[model samples]
Target: MILDRQLLLSNAQALTTGTVFSTNTIDLASARDIGIGDNLELFIRVIAPLTGGTSVQFAYVTSANADLSSPSIIVQTPPVPAASLVAGSEWLRVQVPALSDTTSRQRYIGVQYTINGTFTVGTVTAGLTLDREGLAVYPSGLNTAGF
Candidate 1:
């Protein structure tokens, strides 16, 4: 059976236009204690015109805090060719095996990117899917339900 524990790693946020680097992190769980054989899928959507030379990286980490000193990279797609991100033509999706020999104490997923040139105008969003064997229920207005 498919689990309904879907999580949003990054909201639909506008990319900064220009040569600037930025990182966005979404703490999935303080202590997921994820077990072996579990899977994680990352979905990335970018509104085209993503400006050429722009680089983006997706990763996940297990830490007591949100500091991503070290992270497990899921995927890093090639930079878009200069002026190649025509409108309506940029998107990526990757599946990751979240298996670990040992249980995790915390699980944090995020994305980092550098806008190398002027992106006409666009937004970036990231989502994560956890495959397990149970359903998750949440209380209203409580963002900490993922913990």
Candidate 2:
């Protein structure tokens, strides 16, 4: 068994008020072909000095292309608390639910966030963890083979 944890978004991403930040799109089919299983989870962390009425939310989006349109929010965190911002890093973890039977199912997956109101300088990061099941063969010494 192999474990794969991919960082979809790094810490360099800055939040913009009234704007949305989206991570790179992931090709689920290719990921599965490369031994990534259907079971997946998202880990999100945010650090910011947010004032009252300032809110942040995380969601999963599926699109045919990188330019997402009419996106559907699969899962999201509750609005960030104004007091929590001063406490420390706000974290959220969610499991990806079963996909639909349509062609868009498991096609492209990505993380997106929306920020509102005034926010102090901060960074956000998100990652996807995939559990790979099966033997990892290697043609060369110490190197794992493709699934």
Best by TM-score: 2
Q: Which residue pairs collide, candidate 2?
A: none
Candidate 2 at residue 131, lDDT? 46
Model 2, 57-98: lDDT tens per residue?
Answer: 767767665545556666777777555654346355666666
**How many clashes does each candidate structure show, in the order listed?**
0, 0
lDDT of 2 at 53: 42
Scored against the true structure, residue 1 in model 1 reaches a CA lDDT of: 26
- For model 2, the run of ten residues with the poorest summed lDDT: 1-10
lDDT at 110, model 1:
59
In angstroms, give how far residue 6 of model 2 lies from its true place: 4.9
The Cα local distance difference test for each model comes to 0.49, 0.59
Output the lDDT of residue 29, model 1: 54
Instruction: For candidate 2, report its TM-score.
Output: 0.65
